[model samples]
Target: MVKWVLALVGYFIYRFPGAIAGYLIGTLIDSSFESNKKSGRKGFDTVFTTSRSQNVSPSDFELNLLSLASIVIKADGSVSQTELDYVRAYFVQAYGKERANATFKTFNDVIKNREVSAQRICTYLNSRTRYEVRLQILHFLFGIAQADGRVSSPEVSQLSSIAGFMRINQNDFKSIKAMFVKDANNAYKILEIDKTATDAEVKKAFRTMAKKYHPDKLQHMDEAYQKGARDKFQKVQEAYETIQKERGF
Candidate 1:
């Protein structure tokens, strides 16, 4: 409508060239306005969706962690008090006494019902969490499984299955398992290095493992989770020390 009006006015005032120029200018302005309106809607939708998704907070993370912990604890067809204590201490340390007491009931119910599936939880976590964070979670689960002094074959199989669902690499899963499974008895495996490697290669592997498993890398996590990472970091350091002592380095 506006373009036709502009063109007619232009034709009366200055004939063909003026009509062409006016119509072109009007069409350009109309197209640009429509494009901006569409972009505005898209921008708003993006912001709203992102904010909604990011609403998954640290407490939510802890809940999911506890839920998955329960599943892992029951993997061997038994649930030990030691494993439950490990999880309880985690919540108490991370969420404080009051919150832990409140959340424990839910954790207990989840365990009693046996309704949560490890694979489903792992799938959800994989979709939502970063790889580093998922690795840390796997480390935590291994710690819980070993809290009773040993990680059973069934528990190891369950951990491996969870890692697979989480899209964690097999080598990375084995690296974490080596830290806890003493039956392997190989510091080289703990450091994830070749037995025949030179001292320099061993030192390099230690540094790499140290950096990758550092607790500080998990500062964004809850304090309890950070403590779990610190424990793993110490284990890595211990493995390195053991290698150095045995090799007389």
Candidate 2:
């Protein structure tokens, strides 16, 4: 996070003395991290898991997710480096860098080489995780698919299969899908409504979806996780506003 802030500040002040300030601060922060590297490694366990992300242990969740991610990356019959980096970056942002590094070491050394069963993984998750968390995971997967610019047909098909295994509702799945795939009726699709629905029904659907995708559903996770959740929530808001503007309501 500090790295991002320093980079942003440096970008804005590239021609000014403020860039010097950012560089100095980043140097100090980097040195501090180097000195505390041992403690950071030792402290990975505490930040790796939160008691609030369902009853699934951190290791279990990380393993299952990496397995699924590997499947998604291979779905298009070709792997893209951008997609791989998106997954790595997401983990680094959501968990601290130390724990994310340990998890990815497992991912590269073991999980990526195995044939994982989506059925077993989803069954475990479906039984253990809440609907909201499952939805968030689906959203994350879609983000991965879109990382390389477009969500391909094969990736969407793979995601659909995964969502089915996870017991995600078709309408709910479509709602998230519409966020990535542009279409004329995306606003209606996002709220799980139809163009023929009455204005009252549109308003009702807005409220329903607003509650479903609210960022508070992910309050227990990292701010990065909640920020991702807010993307969905914000999509719902934008969809509703789009409909209202169209209908002049």
Candidate 3:
């Protein structure tokens, strides 16, 4: 039915040149919805736009840290080396080698520091990046996670949390998350509990996860294992928060 309607509209445009003008005007009106949402400019101002302001600043650690969380999401509730490697590559490009390496190392330290919370990651980034840039960064994360042609539940859960921290609309977040989930399993599924899990359950899960991925255990393994452990551990914390929102606890 929609296709038929579109075909009829096309025929009308083909028959009447004046219809082309009307069609263009309609397209402009339709596009205004998105523009209005972006600029917070409404019916009148959008029609007669004034000089627009622009801000170009690099995204802060918060954005990077949250983006890093997306890669840490896994199928078995354990992040894999593939995810860590992706993060390393991303920061290397985003921050450049030397600064990116230092920033990456500092982020790992912060995750391991046991003094900072995942919440701080968003707070820090929110302070540093423009609202539009934060959204773009979040979307870019979805792109990275999907680059391998597969996305897991843990990643989706983390993406949802990051979106929440950014105050992104639920509908919009779902739309973006959907773009990356081309295969089976999702972040919520890997967590093995619904969003409605009780606070006690969340705590229990976090503790079990805490012991499993603790960097301390990986210290005797190899440098790679030890280096990745802390970041993976931080992901466990993020997973717990994802559950928290579902339960409203």
Which candidate, 1 or 3, has the higher TM-score? 1
Candidates in descending lDDT order: 2, 1, 3
Estimate the lDDT of model 3: 0.49
Against the reference, the lDDT scores of all candidates come to: 0.72, 0.77, 0.49
Candidate 1 on 51-87: residue-level lDDT in tens?
2374333334555677788878898998898999988
Each model's total of backbone clashes: 0, 0, 3
| TM-score on alpha carbons, each prediction | 0.73, 0.77, 0.41
Clashing pairs in 2: none
As a whole number from 0 to 100, the lDDT of residue 209 in candidate 1 is 84
Error of 3 at 54 (Å): 16
lDDT of 3 by residue, 17-94 (tens): 534543443344335434545875322222212134322122223234533453343423554456556767765654
Clashing pairs in 3: 153-186, 153-187, 154-187
Question: Which one wins on lDDT?
Answer: 2
Q: Can you give the lDDT of residue 201 in candidate 1?
A: 95
